[model samples]
Structures are given as structure tokens and as C-alpha cells.
Target: MKKPKPLRQEQILGELNQAPSLRVAELARRLAVSTETIRRDLDELTEQGLLNRTYGGAVRSLGTEPSVTERHTLFVSERERIARAAVPLVKDGRVLMIGSGSTTVHVARRIAVEMKNVTVLTHAFGVATVLAINPTIKVIMLPGDYHASEGATVGAHTVSFLQNFHADYAVLGASGLGQDGPADALIECAAVYQAMVSQAARTVVVADRSKHDRLFPARYAHWRDIDRVVTDAAVGSALAEPFRQFGVGQVLA
Candidate 1:
């Protein structure tokens, strides 16, 4: 049998736009090529600033906005690892607040199954549904203007609701993290995340390694505001140091 050719630049970009983060092995399988060929394609994409290379995969550039389903498929293992690391933080009778994102949804699902006597407050409709289905858990929905793409509430209504309530912990997700601060792809989402940060006693950021060092347009919280960041092993030492300098704790899974 003959070896198949690697994906061309256009095909790779198309795949990335559809699914932001993808491992070399997976891409090779999907494109019917060797892992080495996928690696070379990733290198080329990274050089073009179309993607950012991680330990085992590449994430689409910061400016590229992938759909929610696209994000859910990207970095699946890393997100699951982050969720596993975050699950332990939930305690009985504690009010948990979670943001809207793929990783946070996983964390919510784990909490629903594993924990008891918990109150989950979220602006995310999908998260609310996930926890609500678990009869053992108490779920609270914050009212706001619905943003269909994010599947969360945003705007003044949601912010106002959050201000009146406090949570023992807040699990947040970000588009990217940098030396200066945490950022999100959309400004409205950033505003809502910042509101959540202020209302929680301990703020935990649930970000996969792919989020590190990638820049976004709007700023939400700085490293100081985050109590801890739970990510995967792909979080490089170079990115971790700057966050530590700001007194943010980190847990690599």
C-alpha cells in the first residue's frame, strides 16, 4: 500500500476553522497521512500565525472564532483533565458558580454525578440543563439576555443577578491567558466573567494548555484575581512563570 499525502494548507485551515484544536495523530488519521506530515503541516500553520502549537496539538489563532461545537471537540482530553482537577474543589453545601464554555460544562457534569448537596448557579443554559437533570443537585439560573452561540446569559441583567449572590467557588473559562491578564474572544463574555470573578470567594480558571499565551481583544481578570488555574501538562513552564509572578496558583494535570 502507498502512503497518502498530507493535508494541504487550505485543507488544514478548513479543519482548524471547524475544530480549533486538533492533535497531530488525529489530524493524520482524518487526513489519511502520517503523523510526521501532520506535524510539518502544523509547523507551517504556526509559522503563518494561523495556529499555535501545543504539546500534542495545535490551536487556531486567537483572532479565529470557532463555533461552540468546534470548541467542544477541540482539546477534549485536556479539557477533561482540567475538569478532573477542578472536581475536588466542590464541597457539600457550597454554592458553585460556573461560566459558559466546553471545559466548564465538563466540570459541571462531573460535579452533578460525583458531588452532593451542591447549589450550581450559572448563566449557561446548557450547564443548567446538565445539572438540573441530576435530581440530587440544586440548580439556579441567572437571568439575562440570551447569547445563543455561547449558550449563556450576558448583559446587565445577568451581571445584576450575580452581584446579589455570592458563590463559594467560581469555575471560569478563558479564550487565552497572558503575562498581563486573562482575556476572552468576545467583550461581552469578558464582562460577564469579570462579574463572576467579583462575586465568588475563590475563583478557579478552567483552561486547557491551549489557552496559554494566546491573546484576545478584551481583558477580564488579571492573574492576581484568579485563585487558581487548573490546566493540563501541555501548559509550558515559560507560560506558568509569569502567572506565578502575579501570585496565581496553578495545578497541572
Candidate 2:
């Protein structure tokens, strides 16, 4: 009555290749199957190296860290949804710290369009430029060695610059997330993120569902450092436990 497991796996891989991420819940909903079935398929596919499991979903394995340009095109809808959901965490006239990455870039765009009378401190040139267009938004660019591909600055200069000021809120994005906390593929970027969190009263993470259990080179923030997590979908206990341990509130988009 059902297609073979191999056939279903092939279909799943095909979908993943088209989109950067795939959620097990959505797959189960679409296929009229149980979440357990989808999870088993993902586990098998992950073993075969066709896909790697994420927080609440799976993504194709390219064997290398993706460039910022490459990342912008993937998961556009999810990132947009995350941006819209996380924007309210920012209020007018608040001093905000923004991080680099595709998701954070989208969040910057949303804040630029929707909110006013805010000051933004960021190492990302793109984010500074986007928010600078708003008359009510004051953008402060952090000094550092420029990373062209990342459209941001990193290293000691950026880290040193953050010490000069504090922010009401810091909105960040993560490349990977595990039980230990948020990790970044680039160690240098993680340093900047660490500084961002340190200087803010509240740190909010805007991420998609695709970062769960995924570890990267640099572990940046612990659960205690993150005040909130705004994502596209609800996360399971395995991923949510760390937030609970630290009293980090999870907001599903």
C-alpha cells in the first residue's frame, strides 16, 4: 500500500537537495505518515551521508562551511518568518547589537522596515548599511579586519570595540546548535558573537529549525547567555532542555 523505504528516502534526498533544510514534522504531515517513520528515514539517510540531522530538521552535507552568499539563498521563507517573529523582541529607541549571517541579515531588514528610533551596533557591514537607511536608526559600525565573503568584521579589533558600549538587546544567529549551546562554523565569528552577548542586557537568538544538535568549531553562547530563542518551529526536549536549564524562553514563529 505504501512506496518502498528506498523510494521514500530518494524522495527525501531530492527534496533536501532543492531546499537547504527539511523538517521531519512537515514530511510526516505531507506524506500522511507518522513522525517516527520520518525520523527513522532521516537516521538511515544520515548514516548513508546523504543528509545531516539538524535541530528539528535535516540539511544536505556539503562537507564544508557554506559561504554567506550561499547561505542567503537557502531557507529564505524560514528566515523571513524568523525575522518577523523576532522583530518584536526589539522595541523602539533601544540600543541593539546585531550579528552577521543570513538569518540576522533578514532580521536587520525587518527591523529597518518595521521599527524606528533605534541604535544598532554591529560588526556586519551589511547590517549597518541596511539599518543606516532609516532616519530614525543610528548605526554604529564596529572596527575590525574585514571579511569580504562574510560582509562583516572579526578578530581582536571587533572584540575590543564591543567593550566600549552596551546594548539593550543583542540579536544573534547561529550556524549550529548543540546541547552545549550555540556554535559557529568560523571561530573568529564566534569571538565577535561572544562579545555581542557579553555587552547586552538581553540576548535573543534568531535561528531556523535546522541548527539542533549540530556542532561547529566555535562554541559561543551557553544557554544562560541566551535570553530567548525565536525559531520557525517548536523544538523537541532534546534541543529544548538546555534552554529550560538556563531559563531561556523559546518562542516558536
Top-lDDT candidate index? 2
Give candidate 2 misplaced runs (Cα > 4 Å).
1-64
The C-alpha TM-scores of every prediction are 0.77, 0.77
lDDT of 1 by residue, 81-195 (tens): 7888888865543798888888889888888878877788898887887787688788888898888778888999888888998988988888877777778887777888999
Would you list the clashing residue pairs of candidate 1?
none
Tell me the tens digit of each residue's lDDT in model 2 across 141-207. 9899998878899999999999999999999998777788888888889999999999999999988
Q: Candidate 1, which segments miss by more than 4 Å at Cα? A: 1-60
Local distance difference test, per candidate? 0.78, 0.83
Alpha-carbon RMSD, each predicted model: 6.6, 7.4
For residue 228, give model 1's deviation from the true position in Å. Answer: 0.9
- Global fold similarity of model 2 (TM-score): 0.77
How high a TM-score does candidate 1 get?
A: 0.77
Count of backbone clashes for each model?
Answer: 0, 1
